[model samples]
Every structure is written in structure tokens, then in C-alpha cells.
Target: MNRTLTERARSMRIHSGLPKQFWAEAVNTTSYLINRGPSVPLKHRIPEEVWIGKEVNLSWLKVFGCIAYVHIRVFKYKNGSNSVLVVKKDDYDKCNTEKPIMKMDDGDSVFKFDRSGPFFFISGNKDNSQKDQKLIVVVLAIRNHNKFPPVAVPPAPVGQTPASSPSPTKSSPSPAPATTPSPISHTTSATSLSPI
Candidate 1:
């Protein structure tokens, strides 16, 4: 049946009065097939195999372009907790926008937004000292919360001993070195305590 239909289609190529409606339908089908091919390839393409290591996880799944909230630093002047801000993806489209605020869901914290806003993108987690930089910048959604509190800087690395005032000399002698006691052997019988 398909071969017969193909022969008829070939014969119809030479025929001049093939219905105008049929010609229009054929063109429409060809155009539709061409336009649909790219999207079909996208849907049918095999996803790259992802082998997660023991340390990596793939549990959380959120829709792209969905709203999310991120926590920001506490306000400097106000003595209160920081707030959550709404972040969206569309805000990070511009190139010149630096210091964009981004909201991250690292599983430990859940940010709640009071109002909807664009994500303020932050720089990626790459070390800035390296010469070949292809760092991914992260955009953060910062709420109107207070600016982050100053982090307590760690103390300087230990080197010098702290100076102490010299104590008066004492005449007491030093004690002898202590000796370890030998392990004692126990009998097989269990002991019970009696209450009065």
C-alpha cells in the first residue's frame, strides 16, 4: 500500500491540476516537519550520563524560573535577625550589572521572601587569585534586611608565647616521677548491691 501511494505521489508530480488545497497541505507539512525537527531533537537527545560521587546528591528538584528566597546579612544598625528576599532569574540577564545578589539553597537554610524581587548576583565560588579565570558569578536575591554583620575574624596565627610577670622564686622541691599501677585480676563472681 505504501509503495502504491509513493508511485501515485511520483505520478502526481508531473500532473498540473493536483488540487491547490493538496499542494498547500503538502507545503504546510514540509514546513511543519522542518520547524519541528530541532525541538524533537532536543526532546530525543540522550542526556549526558551523570555519575554522582559518594559526596554528591541529586534529591532536590525545583522548577526553573520559579521564585525563591535567600537570606542576607543582618542590618548593621538594627540589632535584629536578617530577612529573606525574593529572587528571580530574569534580573541577571544584563552584562554590566555587577555584584548581583543571588539566592542559594544549600539545604541548611530556607530563605523566605517578604516581597518579590530580582536576584542580586554574587560572584562564583572560584578563587580570585588564579590567572585563568572562568568563574561563574552567582546572583543573589537580597531582601531589604540589614547589611551583613561583621564576621568575627579569627585570631592571628600562634607564634609568640604570651608574656607573663615573673613570679618570686620558691624553695619547694620537685616531686618524683609517678609510676603506673599493674592491672588487678578479677574473680568470675558478679557482685550485687543491697538496699536498706
Candidate 2:
């Protein structure tokens, strides 16, 4: 047990960089874990479980010394938490845009919008398919009122704008494939230019 405690402390010093103030905690936690293991002298019963006469649930155990990526700090927009996904116009056409705000059922992102305007248009998750699919941007959703939702950004590598097929009525500079500008977020769910 002395050897084990010394080895654990050395390992923690080598990698964990935990302060010496927590050496007692390290020794205690290690002792508790060791006590939970099946002991040959105790007829293979875990020392900690022998008192309770129940099987110890080891599921809560984690790597003793490990590095975990809990979160990546960056620009808020780039973090992808509340990201505005920008996809190519060609890719945008594939969306079932009639309703884009999807409901997450059991962690599966399911399309649920009938008309439009539900609360959130969060990032897409895998439906039943095993393949990963690109998430649709929220800007394309048809708003319930006359006002437009957020702007649609084109999914081009940074510093470039994706150029759409030119309308004959207007001539616009083509954004290079390598350089795509943020596409206009406005997409109308226009029925007709009819008088109310």
C-alpha cells in the first residue's frame, strides 16, 4: 500500500500537476479505490462492499489521471453552440424548408415544423441514418410574420462568398469559389404578389 501510494503520488506529480495540499486526498481516494477491489485475504470480497453485503457498483469510476475536452473556448459564433450554419446554395436547396425547426426526440433530431416559426432552430443531429448529414441554417426558415428571420450565411471557407446563379434582370460580381461572401439571409416563402 505504501508503494502504491508513492507510485500514485509520483504519477500525479509527473502529469496531474495537482498541488501537494491535495496529497492526503489523493492517498484517501486511492485507498478507497483499493479497498473496493476484490481482496485475496478477504475471500475475494471487496473490502468496501463486505460491510454492506452488496455488489459494488463500479460504473461511477473514471480514469484516475486523464484529460478531457469538456468545452472549447473561442468566438461565440464559432463555438457552434448558437452557431449560424452557412451552407452552399446548392446544399440549401436540399433542405425540407417548409419546416426547418426540428424537435429532438430521444436525442434524435426529427423534422417537426408544419408551417414555420417554432421556438428554436438549433443545430441538426443525426436522424436514424448512420451517416453524418450537414445541418441546415435557421435563416432559411419562413417566418410566420411579414418580417424576415436572421440572415442566411453561405457555407464557404472563411474569407470567401458563395456566388448564386445570376438573375437575368441583374448583373452581380461572382464571388470566387475560393472566396465566398456571406449570402443574403433573405429567402422568401412567396406564394404570389397578390393584393390582400
Candidate with best lDDT: 2
| Candidate 1, position 131, lDDT | 27
lDDT of the candidates, in the order given: 0.33, 0.46
lDDT value, residue 196 of candidate 1: 9
Write down the worst ten-residue block by lDDT for model 2.
137-146
Off by over 4 Å in 1: 1-46, 50-57, 71-134, 140-196
Which parts of model 2 are misplaced by more than 4 Å? 68-196
lDDT of 1 by residue, 1-196 (tens): 3443333433332132222223332343334333323333447432222122223223463322233555443312212222222223442333222343543333233333344332333223223212222223232232223333544556656996656996778878669789765344323321211100
TM-score for candidate 2, residues paired by index: 0.30
TM-score winner among the candidates?
2
lDDT string for model 2 (1-196, tens) is 7977766655543344444444554566677777888889999989988888888898988554443333222212323323322234443445322334332333322343232111233233323111333433221122123233567655899887787896686667668678565454544442321111
> TM-scores of all models?
0.18, 0.30
Error of 2 at 75 (Å): 31
In model 1, the Cα lDDT at residue 101 comes to 54
